[model samples]
Target: MSRERFVVHLPVLATDLAAAKRFFFCDRLLDGRRRCPLPADHVGECGPSRHR
Candidate 1:
């Protein structure tokens, strides 16, 4: 039998797996195929997580 496989674009190290699992980021889809760059539990309007 064949098993389905999946690929992870961003891979975390085994040692950091625990921390990585706890990390959260906003995944709201935006126009032009962009995603929100804020924390997953952010409040107010969704916007960039940084300012330059």
Candidate 2:
């Protein structure tokens, strides 16, 4: 087995690696095998983004 095979990829920002390291998704399990599409640190509800 190659060492590369053990590497795991994660979502990260290029400009702010420090912040990206701490970033997290809502990942809340929703109905019908769906997940809450929001950031873990989102201010509003834990659903789709509201259009202004």
Candidate 3:
């Protein structure tokens, strides 16, 4: 059997989501590729958390 490879993108909390999004949008448009949308949960102020 053969296995396939995949990529995982961790979401960074967006303290400045609007600005971050504008930068990313322009980047993607200039690069000529569309990517997955950012989730709403990651927006706003970010703080450290314990993930288990």
Find the candidate with the highest TM-score and give its number.
1
Give Cα-based local distance difference scores for all models: 0.68, 0.63, 0.43
Model 2 stretches with alpha carbons more than 4 Å out: 1-18, 21-23, 50-52
Q: TM-score per candidate, in order?
A: 0.48, 0.43, 0.25
- lDDT (10s digit) by residue, model 2, range 1-52: 6333353667656567556634656778777656676766668667774554
* TM-score head-to-head 2 vs 3, winner: 2
User: What does candidate 3's lDDT look like per residue over 1-52, in tens digits?
Assistant: 9667687666666679675564342112212344434333444333333243
Clashes of each: 0, 0, 0
Best by lDDT: 1
After superposition on all C-alphas, the RMSD of every candidate to the true structure, in Å, is: 8.6, 8.2, 12.5
**What is the Cα-based lDDT of residue 19 in candidate 2?**
63
Q: How accurate is candidate 3 locally (lDDT)?
A: 0.43
